[model samples]
Target: MDPVLDDHMHLDPVNGRGVEACEEFADHGGTHLLVLNKPSWHYGVEVEEGGDFQTAYDHTVDVVRESNEVLAGRAWPVLGVHPALISQLVDRGYAPEEARDLMRAGLDTAAEYVADGRALALKSGRPHYEVDEAVWEASNEVMRHAFALGADLGCAVQLHTEDGEDFTEVAEWAEAAGIRREHVVKHYSTGGVVGPTPSVLADREELVRAAERGIPFMMETDFIDDPDRPGAVLGPKTVPRRTRWLREEGYDGALERAHVETPRMVYGIDTRATLE
Candidate 1:
């Protein structure tokens, strides 16, 4: 009974039930969750608002503090200056490098939070396929800085990228940026873990796929906290429920790898607690 961990979940107000969601997860045997806060949730400001470097930085820190309070130490925040936020700056007359430097400054602040142990992970990277090449390149540049920052802070970095991007390529990019492959985890990634790197997946099938490939990965509900689309990604209870289901499905070995081994070895979550 190793402590069950949800590699990803969101508990923001836009989902409109942050505290209740936390309680539901804990009640369902979720010992720890990788919590992410939306920019709009923390600051009244969105990228469209064009907040300056300090404004964005402080907002990220505020989200960290607020999320930690909500979890009461059961979770930590993953902060980053998402490419979409930088796209806003680009629209406002920032050159690619300028936009990236501003995001770099945001990661600097995020790195400090990890150093203080107010947080455990950093989220940074390029956006989806529809982005302009220039914006995407700029975003990668900023993330290079971010990867190095996480490496220095001893934090795992979760990448937000296209759904089926190749792991070897992403791992190469992280290494080129001085981020160890083991330190880089992908968000919303398919269960095709090709290397020693870990990825977050959505369901038992994905987990089974990765296991069949002899790949390592972690599972996530990616539960967007949108009340309108409640359980849009998956419910807060999904991870623990899925873990139990996998155990019953005779995939206990894969479940143990994903729920315990990979999370500890790849993401480096605290594993001092053993399931009795």
Candidate 2:
């Protein structure tokens, strides 16, 4: 059987259902997941300095560790500064350059976790929402810093970006930073990226459309796991359930590539081994 994996999901033990969501995914046949840290603000960590991000990052690592200890399958952690932190810092009277420095420093801390094998990948990106040109440029700088760190750590980088991003310019940044294009993934992506691999959301028609493009890609639910808005951006069970739906629709080959081959290439994780 092809191992089912969710490329992006969150577990907020404090504010949400937490590991119970993992149980839901597992119950529905998920074999593996990449658990990411929520933004620092969500954890009530006022980012005065880069070291402040350690609290949120540590929480995420602990959550993944606990989830792995309980789950029969596996969970890998992804940690980094959320790109929207730029606006938060500026709103609190930070200069764009200062915000950029803080975010880069935060990613440096995240890279430390990756280097120590406490996390599997680093997550960073520019704001998906619009901002001033200076903030946008600063956000890109922070994102490029992530790519550079990924090159040094030899781990994949997951990006949260605006919809319809072609990623042509991002490909240049990856190359200049010495990280492979495929090593950068667009999380919550609906395809159409030219450079970074697309971690496509688990929608049948969208999956079919992405798979038909003949580029490497993977599937994700981007499950937020918030109690206030349960099942937002799809649910915990969406990936495995969608995998079953695709298999039923005779897309077995595509499923194998998405669930197994593509993840191994991009994340260096073999879901087959995790399943075993």
Candidate 3:
């Protein structure tokens, strides 16, 4: 098998390191780097000239734009509305209604970029710090909009569920919201609903149910090599080992078949090698 695609990676070069990492990834024969955009710390703040904020939702769009401009088709933009930052949307200075509207507009703009062949996928699934019913509801609303746009644009939607229960709830809500399971992909299944440990054996059964229901599941490490990041909970070395383990446990062929052949058929991702 070819070097697996790094399905999700966050390499913002606000300080120049991100660009270097992108070059290194491309040099390593990585076909695509899905750059998941998160709001920059400088979002909502005034910046000097040439320091424009271009993040998809807030500061993230700028990063995507720069990366795409620099990488020239080697990078794919993945717009993510991190769960922990939901409150930031309605914080003191920001208007709740206006922020939500801006978010929708941002997603629409991102979707348009993807539709125009400028990006790859529209993804969601960053970790949440303090989730509640309201947060889930808000996130569901965002997901509904993203799925609708993605379906029309022929792009894929990535979901990050905390655990078994959260996954179940998200699935049910997504179905009720009219999001097709075929267009939604789950990321990082090994992370338990509540923590970074391997999912319970029973949760594996639940995953099978999800798979049988048509939801395309894809695994990813949130960050590439940052131990301080949440994806590090499983440890960097552990990620590939888990991938190998899962493959040995009877899902390798299934994963390859689903994400490779079927995903290409459904999402139009090219499986053939093309000289750039």
Candidate 4:
């Protein structure tokens, strides 16, 4: 088997012992592993300990930095707010005004991290934040800001959308807002608030439709082995099969062209690195 590129995985130096896991993954046939910066609370940070928020951010940074060293340049880091954390950013620490300010600063910090080449993608989820119509609109507003920053920074936007909503809404908005097709990618995880099964039948239809329209798309397993985690439903060993299925389903050709051919044309990445 050729080395598989796992595009979306979260590595926490503070928990799940990601450094060791990453080394093991590389030793066992993984070629590239993309890590996303997640909230400290996800790793069990106590709310009372000032949460060591800076330490959490630094921890995520260090993991990516070290992973790059270990992999000899195969690690790709993605930094952005998880949609669930968006409300927390504004509703948690300060007066409503102050909270909004802090949230903006936090996003700026994320941008700076990306500017340093620590992030290859900006990760966000729509289903996590869209609890109501107002929240849905607000979620788009937030995504607009994030997308703008991501575009300026030369990073891709990885979006998580509900299965049924017209994701073309996203593509259309991006086009209207001047975001290029190459800069936006959608992650179709297998299960969760938004996954393959839960995805509206219509959404799946739209994905096929979008492909016909020449939109860039990708499928990700988003699998985690921890039994307590929601993603564990899609076991690790199931990843390859899922990839094969997506390929059989037609999303493969486009994704391969983007990750393999197009990147080579633009960045001079050796296509041999993607050989299977």
Which is the leading candidate under lDDT?
Answer: 2
User: Over the stretch 1-276, how does candidate 4's per-residue lDDT look in tens digits?
Assistant: 433455556666765556665666555445555576666567665332222444556666788777766653366666665555545543565343343334344556677767776556566555553465655555666677666776677666666565543355576666565666445655553222221111111134443543454433332345442335734423333334444544579676644643355444322344356343
lDDT string, candidate 1, 1-276, tens digits: 455677777666432676677677767766667776565424455343223333544433454355445442356567666657776777789887777777787777777767887667888878776778788888878877877887677778887766664668767777776767877888776777553265556577776677666566778888877777888688988878877877787877776777668778766765435232
For all candidates in order, the CA lDDT equals: 0.68, 0.88, 0.50, 0.52
CA error at residue 14 for candidate 1, angstroms = 7.5
| Deviating ranges (above 4 Å) for candidate 1 | 13-15, 40-42, 46-73, 272-276
Cα shift from native, residue 233, model 4 (Å): 5.4
lDDT of 1 at 184: 86
Clashes of 1: 4
- Indicate the TM-score of model 1: 0.85
Q: Kindly list the per-residue Cα lDDT of model 3 for residues 152-175, writing each as its tens digit.
A: 776777665554434555555445
The deviation in Å at residue 242 for candidate 1 is 1.1
TM-scores for every candidate against the unseen true structure: 0.85, 0.97, 0.65, 0.69
**Two-way lDDT contest, 3 vs 4, winner:** 4
Clashes of each: 4, 0, 10, 3
lDDT (0-100) at residue 121 of candidate 1?
81
Give candidate 3's error at residue 129 in angstroms.
Answer: 3.6
lDDT of 2 at 88: 88
